[model samples]
Target: MAEKLGTKLNFVQKDLIKKSTKEPGRVFTVKEVANSYGISENTARA
Candidate 1:
Protein backbone atom coordinates (compact mmCIF):
# COMPACT_ATOMS: atom_id res chain seq x y z
CA MET A 1 0.00 0.00 0.00
CA ALA A 2 1.12 3.56 -0.63
CA GLU A 3 0.85 6.44 1.77
CA LYS A 4 -0.74 9.66 0.53
CA LEU A 5 0.38 13.06 1.77
CA GLY A 6 -2.07 15.94 1.82
CA THR A 7 -1.31 19.35 0.37
CA LYS A 8 -2.28 22.68 1.97
CA LEU A 9 -3.38 24.03 -1.43
CA ASN A 10 -3.87 22.35 -4.79
CA PHE A 11 -2.84 23.91 -8.13
CA VAL A 12 -6.15 25.68 -8.56
CA GLN A 13 -6.05 27.15 -5.07
CA LYS A 14 -2.50 28.35 -5.55
CA ASP A 15 -3.36 29.88 -8.90
CA LEU A 16 -6.35 31.70 -7.42
CA ILE A 17 -4.19 33.11 -4.65
CA LYS A 18 -1.60 34.30 -7.13
CA LYS A 19 -4.24 35.96 -9.28
CA SER A 20 -5.91 37.69 -6.34
CA THR A 21 -2.60 39.04 -5.11
CA LYS A 22 -1.60 40.34 -8.50
CA GLU A 23 -4.93 42.01 -9.16
CA PRO A 24 -5.85 42.99 -5.58
CA GLY A 25 -9.44 44.27 -5.06
CA ARG A 26 -10.76 42.18 -7.93
CA VAL A 27 -13.71 40.02 -6.98
CA PHE A 28 -14.15 36.49 -8.27
CA THR A 29 -17.46 34.67 -8.28
CA VAL A 30 -17.77 30.91 -8.31
CA LYS A 31 -19.06 31.01 -11.87
CA GLU A 32 -16.18 33.20 -13.08
CA VAL A 33 -13.57 31.08 -11.41
CA ALA A 34 -15.18 27.92 -12.73
CA ASN A 35 -15.31 29.26 -16.26
CA SER A 36 -11.69 30.42 -16.13
CA TYR A 37 -10.50 27.07 -14.88
CA GLY A 38 -12.91 25.04 -16.96
CA ILE A 39 -14.34 23.43 -13.82
CA SER A 40 -17.94 23.23 -12.67
CA GLU A 41 -19.46 26.01 -10.53
CA ASN A 42 -20.18 23.47 -7.77
CA THR A 43 -16.53 22.48 -7.62
CA ALA A 44 -15.40 26.11 -7.61
CA ARG A 45 -17.66 26.86 -4.66
CA ALA A 46 -16.22 23.91 -2.84
Candidate 2:
Protein backbone atom coordinates (compact mmCIF):
# COMPACT_ATOMS: atom_id res chain seq x y z
CA MET A 1 0.00 0.00 0.00
CA ALA A 2 2.75 2.45 0.94
CA GLU A 3 4.85 1.56 -2.06
CA LYS A 4 1.95 2.38 -4.38
CA LEU A 5 1.92 5.90 -2.99
CA GLY A 6 5.55 6.59 -3.97
CA THR A 7 6.86 7.00 -0.43
CA LYS A 8 10.58 6.37 0.04
CA LEU A 9 10.26 4.91 3.55
CA ASN A 10 11.29 1.29 3.82
CA PHE A 11 9.48 -1.45 5.78
CA VAL A 12 11.28 -0.80 9.07
CA GLN A 13 10.50 2.91 9.12
CA LYS A 14 6.84 2.35 8.36
CA ASP A 15 6.61 -0.46 10.89
CA LEU A 16 8.12 1.60 13.68
CA ILE A 17 5.73 4.47 13.09
CA LYS A 18 2.77 2.13 12.98
CA LYS A 19 3.77 0.38 16.19
CA SER A 20 4.49 3.65 17.99
CA THR A 21 1.20 5.16 16.88
CA LYS A 22 -0.76 2.10 17.86
CA GLU A 23 0.56 1.47 21.41
CA PRO A 24 3.44 3.83 22.25
CA GLY A 25 4.69 1.35 24.86
CA ARG A 26 7.56 3.54 26.06
CA VAL A 27 7.86 7.31 26.20
CA PHE A 28 10.56 7.19 23.43
CA THR A 29 12.86 9.33 25.53
CA VAL A 30 15.72 10.51 23.38
CA LYS A 31 17.17 12.14 26.47
CA GLU A 32 17.90 8.73 27.92
CA VAL A 33 20.03 7.67 24.94
CA ALA A 34 21.86 11.01 24.96
CA ASN A 35 22.59 10.83 28.68
CA SER A 36 23.84 7.27 28.44
CA TYR A 37 26.19 7.99 25.52
CA GLY A 38 27.09 11.60 26.36
CA ILE A 39 25.61 12.85 23.08
CA SER A 40 23.07 15.61 22.47
CA GLU A 41 19.42 14.61 22.59
CA ASN A 42 18.76 16.02 19.11
CA THR A 43 21.61 13.97 17.66
CA ALA A 44 20.46 10.85 19.44
CA ARG A 45 16.91 11.17 18.21
CA ALA A 46 17.99 12.05 14.69
Candidate 3:
Protein backbone atom coordinates (compact mmCIF):
# COMPACT_ATOMS: atom_id res chain seq x y z
CA MET A 1 0.00 0.00 0.00
CA ALA A 2 1.10 3.55 -0.71
CA GLU A 3 2.22 5.67 2.22
CA LYS A 4 -0.57 7.55 3.93
CA LEU A 5 -0.69 11.05 2.46
CA GLY A 6 -1.99 12.77 5.56
CA THR A 7 0.12 13.17 8.67
CA LYS A 8 -2.79 13.19 11.09
CA LEU A 9 -5.46 10.52 11.08
CA ASN A 10 -9.15 10.65 11.78
CA PHE A 11 -10.63 8.04 14.13
CA VAL A 12 -12.06 6.04 11.27
CA GLN A 13 -8.81 6.04 9.34
CA LYS A 14 -6.85 4.96 12.39
CA ASP A 15 -9.21 2.12 13.19
CA LEU A 16 -9.26 1.05 9.56
CA ILE A 17 -5.49 0.78 9.61
CA LYS A 18 -5.59 -1.26 12.80
CA LYS A 19 -8.25 -3.51 11.34
CA SER A 20 -6.33 -3.91 8.10
CA THR A 21 -3.24 -5.13 9.89
CA LYS A 22 -5.25 -7.64 11.88
CA GLU A 23 -7.06 -8.86 8.79
CA PRO A 24 -4.50 -8.73 6.04
CA GLY A 25 -5.66 -9.58 2.50
CA ARG A 26 -9.23 -8.58 3.43
CA VAL A 27 -10.58 -5.78 1.28
CA PHE A 28 -12.42 -2.79 2.70
CA THR A 29 -15.05 -0.55 1.11
CA VAL A 30 -16.32 2.96 1.88
CA LYS A 31 -19.72 1.67 2.84
CA GLU A 32 -18.34 -1.05 5.08
CA VAL A 33 -16.01 1.25 6.94
CA ALA A 34 -18.64 3.91 7.38
CA ASN A 35 -21.19 1.46 8.68
CA SER A 36 -18.72 -0.21 11.00
CA TYR A 37 -17.39 3.05 12.39
CA GLY A 38 -20.70 4.92 12.37
CA ILE A 39 -19.41 7.50 9.93
CA SER A 40 -21.01 8.58 6.70
CA GLU A 41 -20.02 7.19 3.29
CA ASN A 42 -18.75 10.63 2.24
CA THR A 43 -16.41 10.70 5.24
CA ALA A 44 -15.04 7.28 4.40
CA ARG A 45 -14.63 8.23 0.73
CA ALA A 46 -12.60 11.26 1.70
All candidates' lDDT scores?
0.87, 0.63, 0.83
Task: Compare the candidates by TM-score and give the number of the best one.
Answer: 1
Can you write out model 3's per-residue Cα lDDT over 1-46, one digit (the tens) per residue? 6767565787777888889899999999888988888889998889
For each candidate, give its TM-score against the true structure: 0.77, 0.39, 0.71
Please give the lDDT score for candidate 1.
0.87
Using TM-score as the measure, what is the rank order of every candidate, best first?
A: 1, 3, 2
Clashing pairs in 1: none
Compared with the true structure, the alpha-carbon lDDT of candidate 2 equals: 0.63
Q: Count the backbone clashes (under 3 Å) in each candidate.
A: 0, 0, 0
- 1-46, model 1: which lDDT tens digit per residue? 6554335677888898889999999999999999999999999998
Which RMSD values do the candidates have, in order? 4.5, 5.7, 4.7
> Which consecutive 10 residues in model 3 have the weakest lDDT in total?
1-10
In candidate 2, what residue range of length 10 has the lowest lDDT sum?
1-10
Task: In angstroms, give how far residue 2 of model 3 lies from its true place.
Answer: 19
